[model samples]
Target chain A: MKIDKESIKKIAHLARLEFDENSAEKMSKDMSKILDWVEQLNEVDTSNVEPLTTMSSEVNDMREDKVGTHMSHDEALKNAPKRDSDYFRVPKVLE
Target chain B: MEKFSSFDEIKKSLEKKETDCRAIVEYYLKNIQTKAHLNAFVDVYEQSALEKADQLDEKIAKGKAGKLAGMVVGIKDVLNYQGQEANASSKILKGYISQFTTTAVQRLIDEDAIIIGRLNCDEFGMGSSNENSAHGKVLNALDESRVPGGSSGGSAVAVQANLCTVSLGTDTGGSVRQPAAFTGIIGMKPTYSRVSRWGLIAYASSFDTIGIFSKTVKDNALVMEIMAGHDEMDSTSSRKPVHPYSELLHFDKKVKIAYIQETIDSSALQPEIKENTLSVLEKLKAEGHEVEEVHFPLLKYALPTYYILTTAEASSNLSRFDGVKYGYRTPNAHNLESMYKLTRSEGFSEEVKRRIMLGTFVLSASYYDAYFTKAQKVRRLIKDFSENLLADFDYIIMPTTPTTAFKFGEHSGDPVAMYLEDLFTVQASVSGVPAISLPNGKDKSGMPIGLQILANSFKEAELYAFSNYITQITS
Candidate 1:
């Protein structure tokens, strides 16, 4: 339940977000509170319980594999805030 | 005379030309504008709605109009509709227009339902209250000071305020039901895969469901019938044949209803909510039906399990929104990492950032087993508990929310308190069972309360039948 400031920064990085120093301090406090509350689940006896993944007991409802036209490249790129003719433009990934 | 009390009334009026589609659309448009102070709609497609109405009128003239020929439906911003801004109430998605319509929305259009506009929601369906929306928080129709329960708050409010006949909302952990409870309407989160999620902006792919809010169970059932069924585009959509829901209500078979006494007895529940829910139970018992108390101990851990599973899935699903593709991007970033960080930081709201971070922490390599794995285990226990209980009970019932609608700022400062608002409702999402919130009665402050009815997976017909029966008895 003890969330360090360093951990908050790391979490932000992992989440692909940026947090200013003040926001990081606030997040540390809030994150600690949430973690503390969730820690209550530790007290419950789940030894006999199985972890749930899918909601349905039934499995394998997969559809037939079929090729279909999805959105065209132009249509897909239409919503991109920053896009070039052939691709969504972002700051260069490599230096 | 009573302003289209039900869809049936609207259908009759449209047939008789008592009110043309354009007039109905305009009337609702005026109502939506007047209620703009509530911030219910993100965008009102006035010209498009009018054009659609004209087309429907032409269809009516050709005798080809369907049951919902002139009815208007408000859509949640998360669902895609062709050429409309599917903002999802986030700065990250600001100015983004959908290229294709969601299957559910497209079906409504095929059945002649007019798309009035898009309703506001919490950014990416993150918050229990509407306060997290970039568009602005939606006020409860009944009380401006209180939240309309979210991330489906605007959808619920639009229906309650009669801006639209019914609205579509996506329920991921009580988004639809809780808001319906707050606004005195009916909301249904159908069984997973019962309704296709194609073109729905994914928040938590596994738990997210396309739900409906209406003034009556009949309207909800009718709208759901049109929208439910398999879609080739959506992998999770059910292949089962869609049934006429209204016909199921006529069956005279007695149904067994189960109430979670432990949940009812919880001290965390407000006294008025408890009282109102019990009164609904008494009403059910007054009718010639079976009602019993059942225990599902694993439900106590439902909220935590839901938070873990949903956040983990969200962390992955939202990864595609990395500013470079189909959403807001920062011009100042000199590198890709900074671009991703800056765009998201500026685009997403604080609540969204908090959830993304929490999701990252739980799903991170080292913590996955301790947090995510353990939560999934708890989720399995919860699902197993529901499965076991459903063997004996036909439908499970509980108070939709622990308390009635709270003031807008009541839990705004405390994130944990807001999350706890979902306690009574998360179990159904975890189990993927069909659940609905029906307005039970009013609290001490005269705000509406709701009773949640949950049934086994894909048993939506039975759930609707039970809900209809209950509504009849209570009325």
Candidate 2:
């Protein structure tokens, strides 16, 4: 339940978030407290219990395969931070 | 002749042409402006609301007004209202405009409801107190110094203060009912998937249900009747037939109610709330309804299980907010890696980041079974057990919160204690059952005390019937 600073940093990296040493130390402390609280679930016997997926087990209503777009190209790109023409622009992955 | 207050009274007045929709809209706009210090609204669509009100007035003249003809409404910041800033009160979505309307809001519009503004809320619906909102905290209208139970704090305040007729709020684990309790109004979270989640900003998909905050049970019932139906757009939307909840509120059958002994007898609940809840039960029993005390030992585990599952889902749901596609991007980032990290770290608040980290840790390779899977299994146990109890009991009544509205800085220092504010309400979210909070009584300070009524999944009609009966006798 004691989430160390290094572990917090690794998880932050995995979650696409960055924290300085100070915030990371704070996060480590907060997570330890929260996780320690959540550790009480271990006291319950959930053996052989299936993980509940959705709210209901109702069969998903399937639809025919069809091609459609919710938004026009312009509308879709409207909120992008950087966009060129119709595509979102991100930093170049390759040199 | 009496003052028009509730939705039905307003509807009658509008139909009789005693008052026009435009006048109603103007009155609510004035109220919103006057109560601006409450910080309930993130943005007010003044022009659009007036224009819609004018059109509805025309429709009324022609006898073609829609179901919600003269009603004015406010939407929570988390729902997309099309071309409006539905930012979920977070900095990450600061400048984002919704491209499409959520099904729920669209239905409201179709019914001739004028949407006055978008209400504030906890950032991405995370915090128990409204203080987490990036825009600013929403003060409880009852007492500005006290916190309005949140993340639906603004929506609750809007209704409680009469800024709008009814406001839409999303409840993902006590967001709707808790705040409604704090503000002393009727807040109902319909069964999960009862209302479509198509354009709702996701917090926890399974638990994210669009709820309504209104002053009367009938207003909530009517709105639920209008909005609850199958939407092909949202796969999780229930395909079952939507019941006529508003019309069915007069089912006078006696209800067999159960109150959890642990919840009422617990030391955590404040004595005032316990006394009020017990009084309400006694009132129900006095009405010849069967009210029993049920032993619920699993009450303690509901909170931890809720946190684990919701945060795990939220971590995955919120990952889409990275800088590239939309929302806030760091001013300087040379590479994609730094861009993602900087954007997220700068965009999210400390609470959000902590939850994301907790979620990531739980779903991490080493602790997946111990946390995520274990929580999921426990979730099933809670859901099934609660549903079985609901099968035998007509309704489960409990105190909405352990204590009433807390002072501004009371529990903000400890996240766990703040999270425990949901101890009594999360059972409904975890079980996907329909639950409602109504003004039970008040503390000595006159701050409201709310009692919750819960029914089985998709049985909102029965829930409303019981609520209407309770309201009638109590009033």
lDDT per model vs. reference: 0.87, 0.90
Candidate 1 chain B, run of 10 with poorest lDDT:
B1-10
Tens digits of lDDT, candidate 1, B1-475: 3476568778888777788888888888989989899889888999999999898888889998877887899999999999888889998988888899999999998888999999999999998889898898899979888999998999999999989999999999999999999999999999888898899999998899999999888889989889999887776688778888866766467778899878999988999989878888777787666899877676778898888778889888888888877878887899999988898889888888788888888888998878888888777777778877887888888999998899878898889889999999898998888899999889889899999999988787888888887888777
In model 2, what is the error at residue B111, expressed in angstroms? 1.2
For residue B107, give model 1's deviation from the true position in Å.
Answer: 1.0
How far does residue B333 in candidate 1 sit from its true spot (Å)?
A: 0.8
lDDT at B287 for candidate 1?
67
Q: In DockQ, how does model 2 score against the reference complex?
A: 0.78
lDDT for each residue of candidate 2 in B1-475, tens digit (9 for 90 to 100)? 3344689989878767788888888888888899999999999999998898888888888989888988899999999988988789999998999999999999988988889999999999998889998999999998999988899999999998888899999999999999999999999999998999999999999899999999888999999999998888998898889988999988667779999998999899999999989998999889889999999888889999999989999999999998877789998788888888889999999899888888888899999999999999998898988899999998999999999998888887788988999999999999999999999889998899999999998899999988988888877
DockQ of candidate 1 is 0.68
Error at B352, model 2, angstroms: 0.6
Which residue pairs collide, candidate 1?
Answer: A51-B377, A52-B376, A52-B380
Q: What's the lDDT of the predicted structure labeled candidate 1?
A: 0.87
